[model samples]
Target: MATASTIFSDCSSSTTARLVPLSRIRNGILQFRQSVSVGWKPKNPSLNFISTHGRSSSSIVTVAMATEPSATVIDGKSVAKKIRDEIRSEISRMKDATGIVPGLAVILVGDRKDSATYVRNKKRACEAVGITSYEVHLPENSTEEEVLNSISGFNDDPSVHGILVQLPLPPHMNEETILNEVSIKKDVDGFHPLNIGRLAMRGREPLFVPCTPKGCIELLHRYGIEIKGKRAVVIGRSNIVGMPAALLLQREDATITIVHSRTKHPEEITSQADIIISAVGQPNMVRGSWIKPGAVIIDVGINPIEDAQSPRGYRLVGDVCYEEACKVASAITPVPGGVGPMTIAMLLSNTLVSAKRAHNFE
Candidate 1:
């Protein structure tokens, strides 16, 4: 059995070394954690392939790396900022020409900290881009009827162009029924069945696509990643991201395969894809071996794992193990700064579009 000490030695060499999958070396290793930052050099340079910074002398582990360019870090944060800037300019123009400003209304029915943070971020994003933000916060015990009433109010308000109900509503409430109440025209989060249905059908378009999935596709487009005729794999089948993402990719003329819990040998399918969008929400679930060299990866999962070294007591990681994927993939998105920002940017975008349509503004 090749032990961790044998696999990773205190040595330096000019030759390259392929990273062996952790699964294969787990039995021989003392511990392993994904690296949050990576730098690539295709020549003689000190390689910090994997960090064992806090380890005891007896458990020190380090691995050599291949002299190849790492995957391009898809800068979704910058791209999203650019999109927001574009929206800001467009909103300014629309307001100047027609006295109309885009507005977004959000209904929150619970006290979930994460949900509140998301709504708060969204409101700030809207304000940053000249969009009027309206929010209604209800207690956890609020009735579905109360939530429906809020949606109805937003729906009837012509000034409010987009409406979103923060997800994972109280267990007592019927999510589908509440989501269905948001007028299809104002469904900025794009959870409305009509929007999803329209997205799945050809020769038809939805009023809005789900923000996260839409953002994933937008990232690919902005990066000039070709989707047409490409083999694409979408991990997970959740309605919010996975399903709609597959539909969106198919619309782009990509041959698609969906990998889910029931998938047997999911790696085989992913390894064959040219583009992979993973929304499984499982941290570091996709390994390097699952990726084809030069493939594009859009990681939609923002999973938090414990990290004592951080101020927050934890850190966020993507569904794809970035350290591994960065080596094999041509381009990839990082977790906290990647698709996260784009989701809000897309929401603002949908609001702008809705306002344009409502006012017949060009």
Candidate 2:
């Protein structure tokens, strides 16, 4: 086993020499201890650093390059698979012990193709994790009351441990009212005002966290990225993604700045962040220059743009310019394979968590 000092000393980085704290070393110890306890050997014992350069906080481009080779690409898809497998094993154990299988209920209102696809994927993910999935589909003309009634029914259903209402509900329906109608205990999507409020306030535990943001942080943790006291910039402020992402990042002690469409000089602000998470839904909106050289880039955008060579007639893209970002950023996530799959994995994990809490399985 590699000692914490050995892990940090192997990297010839002067910035890391100063910034690496005993607390971070202690965290590495905890992670190693958890791996040992779980009967899993550490895959890569060397510490991975998310580097930032050309920033006012530190002048350390040399260290950034020295540490770049030591950093590993955070494989969210693989990590999500491991998480799902763990959940499946746990679910199997619970079923054998208590004769109960966790169930998740998803509500989809309207006929949007993308929404339908997301719902199908969620159902498939639930099944893969041994969780039963129940879905309700409604027409575009459905009233807000109808949606609320469906949620109320799920809330009362003893078998349904988690409830998720597909987003982009018809313009006529009140999204907030429909979402709030789902009992907080079953609010697996974690969009309820109560959950969001708890997440924003310190020392309050949320019943569940929104899936996408939770996955982002999970990537950081699994890959050993240091978030405490680092500058993090979230580009975009959608209630579903960007806003929640910023809040979650802040919880990890990262000084967070939100860059929205209306914000002037978005790049200028983003360029200063040690960690950059972009969820703006615009293809290649965040240029390479916007990133501080060697910063960790988490691209959350899933935009489909024209591509004649493909059979699908288009290709998926992220908010960051991938080709340029890969060269400038120390580490960057690829579109489609990055944040998309992790979102569903987190949903299943949260459902399992809800079931365990409801049944006292843990």
Q: Which candidate comes out best when scored by lDDT?
A: 1
Q: Per-residue CA lDDT of candidate 2, range 86-190, in tens? A: 999999999999888999999998898767988898899989889999999999998888888899999999899999888777888877788889899998888
State the weakest 10-residue window (summed lDDT) of model 2: 27-36
Output the lDDT of residue 36, model 2.
Answer: 11
| Candidate 2 global TM-score | 0.79
After superposition, which runs of candidate 2 have C-alpha atoms over 4 Å from their true positions? 1-72
* Estimated TM-score for each candidate: 0.84, 0.79
**lDDT value, residue 145 of candidate 2:** 86
Looking at candidate 1, the ten consecutive residues that score lowest on lDDT are 23-32
